[model samples]
Target: MIIQKEISLKPKSRGFHLITSEIYNHLPELKEIKTGIAHIFIKHTSASLTINENADPTVRSDMETYFNKLVPENATYFEHTLEGKDDMTSHIKNTIIGSSLIIPITNGKFNLGTWQGIYLCEHRNYGGTRKIIITILGER
Candidate 1:
């Protein structure tokens, strides 16, 4: 079976945010799947998706800090800066991180590690609502 849905996430500041629960909460179909895979894709170029530490909030903060340092805004060579200083940098960060994730599912639950969680890599300063397309493929 294949199920797909698009969800809008509340806007967030530029950072790495744990959205594991939020994503799972939107997927009622997941409960019916005995085993499968979940494909989560972000619909914006300024944002991306990833999986990482879920236990400590510091991890998220650290990730944001690291990425900002790695991809500073207003670079001289960036041509896509009409949106804002963060615009071009956001795209670069999205490329470095990615725009989607594929995770295993089992017994109606995501097979993530104990400390693993889904993260929305919001790179823009005022990134509005993010739209995610979640596709679940599995067996009953």
Candidate 2:
């Protein structure tokens, strides 16, 4: 059986937001499932999904800084700027980070490596509410 779920999230900042726990907590109420796969997807053009280290806050901060440097907000060579200065940069970031992740599951639980976590990367320079799509596929 494949179960699909969607979650709405409000980010407090303009960067990566750890959301692994929330998705882990909302798996499902099914039984008889042994092996499965968890697919997480972010439904936004200006944002992305990243499965990375979530144990320390510094890692997240450093990632944000790195992306900013990779795609500077006020570069004088962008074309899509009707939204704001961060609009084009946000799109660039999203392209690099991607928008979905697939994780293996065993015994009805996600199979994540040590310190591995799921994050919603908000490239825009402001807080906003975004949608997360969670899908589980397995035997049941």
**Which has the greatest TM-score?**
1
Cα lDDT of candidate 2 equals 0.83
Candidate 2 residue pairs in clash (backbone atoms < 3 Å): none
| lDDT of every model, 2 decimals | 0.93, 0.83
Best by lDDT: 1
Across 13-83, the per-residue lDDT of candidate 2 in tens digits comes to 78887888777666654234688887888888899999989799898899999999999876899999999
Q: Give TM-scores for every candidate, taking all chains together and pairing residue i with residue i.
A: 0.97, 0.92
The window of 10 residues in a row where model 2 has the poorest summed lDDT is 24-33
Give candidate 2's error at residue 27 in angstroms.
Answer: 2.5
lDDT of candidate 1 over 119-140, digit per residue (tens): 9999999999999999999999
- For model 1, the stretches where C-alpha displacement exceeds 4 angstroms are none
